[model samples]
Target: MFESPNELNIARKEHKHLSFSAGIYYCLGGQAAKLEIEVAFNCLCDKFKQPRLQEEPVWRKNSNMHGMEMLMIAI
Candidate 1:
């Protein structure tokens, strides 16, 4: 489980993620955020012929935040 949170394993049958909070504390912009991501990915797919990673992603060092610090991609 130590390594599980470091990667995007979409194929996992079950998982737990709390990025947008939950219940009464749920993020109001969660849906909007999802929509924005979807639109951005769609646009990238339409605009780029074959975009690929230019280098390995650098992940953030913050224990409180789990995300990439730099993700270079080549179009």
Candidate 2:
């Protein structure tokens, strides 16, 4: 943000991008997605040791859709 008429904001500590956009383009599923991701990470950390990729991931052709077709993880 700029300081045209007010304050220019900056992070005082750590920073991370969540990608929860604003206005009409904002992701309506952002909260749910964040919750799911947190739960999944917790589960993985609790149940597994150091996880690693076992093979190259396969992806779909849909440009708007971002995900893996098959992910093989070795702990």
Best model per lDDT: 1
lDDT of 1 by residue, 1-75 (tens): 435666544355553457788889988999999799879878887999987778877899987977889978799
Candidate 2: pairs in clash:
none
Error of 2 at 14 (Å): 12
- Candidate 2 shows a clash count of 0
List runs of model 2 lying over 4 Å from the truth. Answer: 1-22
> What would the per-residue lDDT of candidate 2 be over residues 28-73, giving only the tens digit for each residue?
9988987997799678768988766677666656667645677677
Candidate-wise lDDT, in order: 0.76, 0.62
Candidate 2 residue 47 C-alpha distance from true site, Å: 0.2
